[model samples]
Every structure is written in structure tokens, then in C-alpha cells.
Target: MPPPALLYALAGIWISVIGLRSVLVEEHFFRKIVASNIFGSGVFLVLVALARRAPEGPPDPVPQGMVLTGIVVAVSATALMLALLGHLHDLEKPDNQEDPS
Candidate 1:
């Protein structure tokens, strides 16, 4: 059987591909945002898997640290994207206020 790290890497690759495809094909901005998150998660998974490649030695700390930092950035980016989307949605709505006489 293949090593666990190999399996994780393969899964991460598959997930990244799927997410990228969705991001490219989907028209909705919300879906694209979700897909982007998936892509980021897959990248992090792959990085972690790579860091664990040397089973006999201690895992690399750099990739793990990078992944942690990336997660923080991703969350912040997602929040900003969501806020922008909300603003765009509000802007697209027709005004319902009555005109002053």
C-alpha cells in the first residue's frame, strides 16, 4: 500500500483541480469564493503532506508555518470578498424610498 502522505497528496491534488475547475466554470461570485477557499485548503494539505515526506526524521517546520500563515490570509481575504459581494448586492437593488412632496 502507498504511504499515508502519498494518499494525502493525491487527494489534495484532486481537490485543487476540482476547485480550480469550479472557479473557472461557475458564473456566480459566491461560488467562485467558495471554490477559492477549497483551492487554498487543498494547497495547504499538499504542503503538509510534503512536509511529512521524511518519515525517519522530524517533519519540516517551514511548510507547516507557511500553511498556518496562509490559512489566516485566506480567512481575511474571504471576509473581504464576502463584504464586497454584499455591497455589490446592495448596490444592485432598486431603491424603494418614496419621494418627498
Candidate 2:
């Protein structure tokens, strides 16, 4: 395997290990967020690796397209979820926001 390909494979493996460890250990909300970040990033790495060896024939548009779509969706979902979590926390303790009643 080429050096770049090998490096990518090793990185992918390491990221997968981190993801697994994240699951087995303590799972606080922040930790879970970190894990999600790792996992989504790992998937992106895999897609990139596949793209590295992508064939010239017949075009590999599908894989590229899917990865691009996934990146957008994952980023949006993560941002929304994090925002919602923060909002929930704020709701739990409304120090700044005055209560209506």
C-alpha cells in the first residue's frame, strides 16, 4: 500500500479505537458529544480513504456524493442537538430569563 493510504488506514484504525473506548468508559453528555464527533469524523476518514483508491472508470460520483451529503447532515444534526442540549440546560436554570409567573 502507498504511504498515504497506509497512513490513512492507521488513522482510521486509531479513530475507531477511540470511538470504542469512548463507548466502554464513562458516558457523560460532553463525553457523548466528543464520541459523536469522533465517530462522524472517522466515517469521513473512511469515505476519504475509499476516494483515494477510487477508480477512474464509470466515475465514483456516488461515493463522493454520499459523503458530501452525510457531512452536511451530520454537521447540522450535531449543531442542532448541541444547541438543544444547551437550551434544555438553560431552561432547567433560568437565572437570566425572568419567569412569567
Candidate 3:
């Protein structure tokens, strides 16, 4: 109901749109990962803000903690995924037998 909540909702909407654009218009590996990350972050932020808006009584620390944990886990997962992809890419190096030009 606050200004910040409205801002978070708007940001979430924009981020979802950007992610959809990347999936619809981009065909690059990097773009896919970047878009996925943005989407994930936006969803988490919206959930966190919603949790923050819960009734004042007792307050829900669970959601707050979950969002924090999700953030760390998501970043680590992204790094591992990218690293693995890079390793696979290195293995697919162009052979001297043929030119990609």
C-alpha cells in the first residue's frame, strides 16, 4: 500500500517484460542467462516486498530470510552454470580442419 511497494511492483513488471523480450527476440547464450537472472531477481524482490507488507503483528521474518537466502543461492547457481557452459564451450573450439568464416 506504500509508495515503495508500488515501485517494487512496477519494477517487477518491467523486469518480466524485459525477460520476455530476451526470450522472444534474442538467440544468444549470454542473453538467455542474463535475462533469466533478471527475471529471478525481480520475482524474488516482489515476493520480499509483499512479505514486508504483511500485518504488523509479529511480522513475518520467514519471507525476509527466505528472500535473502534465495539471492545468495541464485547467484551461486548462476556462476556455476556459466562456468560449466564456458568449460563446454572451450571443448568445442574450432578445429584446424575447417574455418567458420
Candidate 4:
């Protein structure tokens, strides 16, 4: 039987590949943003899997810390991307105006 970590690593790699493909192939900006988030999540999962190298001992703290930090960064980046997307959407809308008589 394969170890749990190996399974997680494989899943992460698969997810990352899928996300990357979507980011490259999708035409919409929103879809690209979502794909980027998925890619980040997959990377975090891989990091977590790597951290669990020693089953007998406690998992390494460094990778765990890095993952935590990365999560925060990812969230912030996603928020920023969403805000930018919203701004772009607003800009694309046809503005309605009342002409002064």
C-alpha cells in the first residue's frame, strides 16, 4: 500500500497540473484567478505532504510555517485580484448619463 503522504503528493501534483492548464487555456480573467488559487492550494498541499517526512517524529515546523504564511499571502493576493477584476468590470460597463437641458 502506498503511504498517505505519497498519495497526497500525487493528488497535489495532479491538482496543480489541472490548475495550471486551466490558467493557460481559459480566456476569462475570473477563471484565471480561480485557477491561480487552485494552483496555490495544490502547492500548499504538496508542502504539507513534504513536511510529514518522518512519521515517527513530529512533522517539521519550517514547511508548516511556510505553508501558513503562504496561505495568508494567497488570500491577500486573491482578494486583490478580485478587487482588480471588479474594477475592470466596472470600467467595461457602458456608463449612463443624463444630459443637462
Candidate 5:
């Protein structure tokens, strides 16, 4: 069987590439946010995979902690981006008081 690191690294590269492509191609704000989250997840996957170098030893805690922190930060940033997108959309809406004709 292939090593865990190799598998994880491949998956991370594939996922990150896909995320990057989506981010570049998509025009909508929500799609871009989702793609960025996917890219971040791939980065975390690579970090965890690096921590598993030896088969006999336990994984280090520092990288794991950083990954967890990154997750939290990514979530908060996504939420903030979504809120800003919503506000911008609301502002762009034509005022109801204006004449439709």
C-alpha cells in the first residue's frame, strides 16, 4: 500500500487545484467563498500529512492546533464575507420608491 503522506499530498494538490480553478472561473461571490474554503481545507490536509512522517511515532500537536485555529478563522472569515456580500446586494437593489415606469 502507498504511504499515508503520499495519498494525502495527492489529494491536497488535487483539491487545491480544483478550488483555485473554481475561484478563478466563477463570477458569483458565494461560489468564490466556497472555493476558498476548499483551498484552505487542502492546505490543512497537507499540514496534517506532513505531521505523519514516521509510522511509529504519534503526530505532533502544534500543527494540529494550528490547523484547528485555521479552521476557526476560515469559518469566521467566510461568515464575514457572506455578510458583506449580502449588504452589497441589498444596497444595489433598486429603491421601491422609484417609479417602475
Candidate 6:
């Protein structure tokens, strides 16, 4: 029966640690990209949890705005990385196959 804030904070920290490990241990570019995204999400989760601590005050816009911006950036970066991976794969495929002509 931990408090909701403690639970959220712990979860965020756990996710961040996992993400950091994946980024460090994995050699693949795709895996690194995903790990980075996970790390960013963990940061957002922690921030939201902090915001919840001050329920008396009006909700803060700064944290919300930061999280929103982060999400947009992360999505864009992932899309770009995926596109690059696809292009690289396509280029490598021709080299692996024997010429049929």
C-alpha cells in the first residue's frame, strides 16, 4: 500500500533504469532508439508524479507543456530512425542476393 505518488515515482525510476541499460548494452541502432524513448517516457512519468504532489495549487502548465513537447520530438526521431533503418536494409539486401539476370 504505497501512496500513488511513491508508486508512480518508483515505476518511473525503474523504467528509466531499464531503458538506460538497454541503450548501453544493445548494439543495434533500433534498440538504442527505443530505449531512449523509454527513458524519455520515464522522465515524463516522474514529472507528472511530482506535479500531483501539489494538488492544492492550480495545475502547472510548464510540466505538461514539456511532456507534450518531448512526446512530439521522440515520435519524430523514432520515425526518422525507422525510415533510415528501412533504407539501410534495402541497400544491404541487394548485396546479399546473387544476381539472377
Q: All models: lDDT?
A: 0.93, 0.73, 0.75, 0.91, 0.88, 0.84
By lDDT: ranked, best first: 1, 4, 5, 6, 3, 2
**Top-scoring candidate (lDDT):** 1
Q: Report how far residue 85 has shifted in candidate 1, in Å.
A: 0.1
Local error of candidate 2 at residue 21 (angstroms) = 3.1
Q: Is candidate 1 or candidate 3 better by TM-score?
A: 1
lDDT of 5 at 88: 83
Q: For model 1, how does the per-residue alpha-carbon lDDT over 18-49 read when each residue is reduced to its tens digit?
A: 99999999999999999999999999999999
Pairs of residues at least 3 apart in sequence or in different chains that clash in candidate 2: none
Error of 5 at 83 (Å): 0.6
Task: Give the TM-score (vs. native) of candidate 4.
Answer: 0.89
Task: Encode model 5's per-residue lDDT on 1-101: one tens digit a residue.
Answer: 98978799789888988999998999999999999999889988888887787776798788889999999999999999999988887788856446678
Ranking of all predicted structures according to TM-score, beginning with the best and ending with the worst: 1, 4, 5, 6, 3, 2
What TM-score goes with each of the models?
Answer: 0.89, 0.69, 0.71, 0.89, 0.85, 0.79
lDDT-wise, the better of 3 and 4 is 4
Error of 5 at 86 (Å): 0.7
Worst 10 residues of 6 by lDDT: 51-60
List candidate 2 stretches off by more than 4 Å. Answer: 1-3, 54-59, 96-101
lDDT of 5 at 66: 92
lDDT of 3 at 11: 84
Question: Candidate 6, overall lDDT?
Answer: 0.84
Which run of 10 residues does model 2 get worst, by summed lDDT? 52-61
lDDT of 3 by residue, 29-50 (tens): 7777788788777777677667
